[model samples]
Target: MAGVQDQLEIKFRLTDGSDIGPKSFPTAASVATLKETVLAQWPKEKENGPRTVKDVKLISAGRILENSRTIGECRSPLCDVPGGVTTMHVVVQPPSTEKDKKAAHLPKQNKCVCVIL
Candidate 1:
């Protein structure tokens, strides 16, 4: 038991209908860090793929995993196979930025109030 490894292997179900390998990582790996690895392995040709970590969300068991959660803590939500391999779904969202805050043009009109003396 001294040298036993609690390695967790997971596969990512990309939005593009592609699958990533059952990559191995320590059970202690944070969800935040795992996103980076997924980003690295993401296909460059994925036009709608995430451009940054903030643009991606990792979900398991119909819940979005927080950045602070350890991979071990998330194991329960996933379906573990005989080999302990699990799969997670990826959701890509557009990053929130000033671009989204642009104001829309409104038609200019003036109204005058009439008072009868």
Candidate 2:
């Protein structure tokens, strides 16, 4: 109870309208730490979930928080309202494998051609 002043209530809102937490965290916690927590508590039923922390991205106050940034550094009037739960949007993008990477460079199947005389 004594350290509550430095704690922040945060919850992650997934793209599917699901949430991960409304948990308390010290202001010193890093964004990377939050990502790990997300990975640990990720919804088991969700499809195409992130396989690692690198795949998780957190957005708060309309800004994409960097992994090196701390929670205290992210406090803003737009999202970190006093005594209110801060909702951070979570985006999961799985790392691309060799096959996917190669396919991405390939040309598209359909192309439009136009010529004017």
lDDT by residue for model 1 (29-95), tens = 9999889988899888778777888887999877799999998788774375545767889998876
Per-residue lDDT of candidate 2, residues 1-114 (tens digit): 658768999999999898999999999999999999999999898898999999999999889999999999988966577788999999998788999989999998877888
Considering every candidate listed, which one attains the maximal lDDT?
2
Candidate 1 pairs with clashing backbones: none
Residue 72 CA displacement from its true place in model 2, Å = 0.4
Model 2 stretches astray by more than 4 angstroms: 103-116
Q: What's the count of clashing pairs in each model shown?
A: 0, 0
Stretches > 4 Å off in candidate 1: 1-5, 97-99, 102-117
